[model samples]
Target: MERKEYYAVIFTSKRTDGDNGYGKMAERMEELAGQQPGFIGIESARDANLGITVSYWESLEAIKHWKENSAHQTAQKLGKSSWYEDYFVRICKVERDYGMNE
Candidate 1:
């Protein structure tokens, strides 16, 4: 099947100097996000200093719903307070995508 237009929420973050249950919370959030109405998938990478996570959704409204989720809001607050040094979130329209056919 051909790919269709979708929304992607790009989250880039720099973390503070500790674990502090970030791993557990991140895992939980991913699990929760998968259960959301518009959630399609998520890709993420992290290192000692910085991390990037992108989540795909069927629509902008779905993205907004995930953003306003109560658990996600708590996680965002905790990120600002303890986990992240800085972060940015960008929502973009993914009009086209291609992948290798190997």
Candidate 2:
């Protein structure tokens, strides 16, 4: 079967006061997501008050499943409560993507 391609979900969040727990939760989420059937990979970054994460998936269904996952949902709730003051999620399809190793 040919694999269907999907947009990469890019999430950016601004952290609030108690963000120490975010790192651990984020790592766990990534690890768990990586174990999912359609997961590709993930990349994340953080600055003084901002956190950015990009995760690649095989389909929108996979992304939705991850969003609705229990542990991930809990982390999302905690993100709203303690880690992130605000966040934005964007999905962009890779019509044409290329890279070179340096």
Candidate 3:
């Protein structure tokens, strides 16, 4: 696959020390997401009070399915109640993309 289309999700959060178990959750999410139909790949980053994760997919439906996934829902709950003080998610369609692999 050329991976021309992508869902760019930006998540910003206020993380708590003990509750921000991102290392484990991130790994698990990546493993699960890779198993989903239409999933392409993901890129992510984080800072003191912010986190951004972008995942690529074949269609809107695939993205929706991931959003409604049970594991992801559990993560969301943990994020809201414990890990994150606040956060945001945005999905966008890619019209054109260019890159180089070295």
lDDT of 2 by residue, 1-102 (tens): 233556699999888876477768877998999998778889888888778899998888888888999999999888877887799999887665555741
Q: What is the C-alpha local distance difference test score of candidate 1?
A: 0.94
Can you write out model 3's per-residue Cα lDDT over 1-102, one digit (the tens) per residue? 255656655565667776468679979999999999989889888877677778888888998899899999998888778887677777888877766851
**Candidate 2 at residue 90, lDDT?**
97
Selected candidate, larger TM-score, 2 vs 3: 2
TM-score of each: 0.95, 0.87, 0.83
Candidate 3 global CA lDDT score: 0.80
Model 3 per-residue lDDT at 6 = 64
Cα error, candidate 2, residue 50 (Å): 2.0
For every model shown, the clashing-pair count is 0, 0, 0
Q: Write the per-residue lDDT of candidate 1 for residues 1-102, one digit (tens) a residue.
A: 456999999999999988898999999999999999989999999988889999999999998899899999999999999999999999999998887862
- Between candidates 1 and 3, which one is better according to TM-score? 1
When summed lDDT is taken over every stretch of 10 residues in candidate 3, the lowest stretch is 1-10
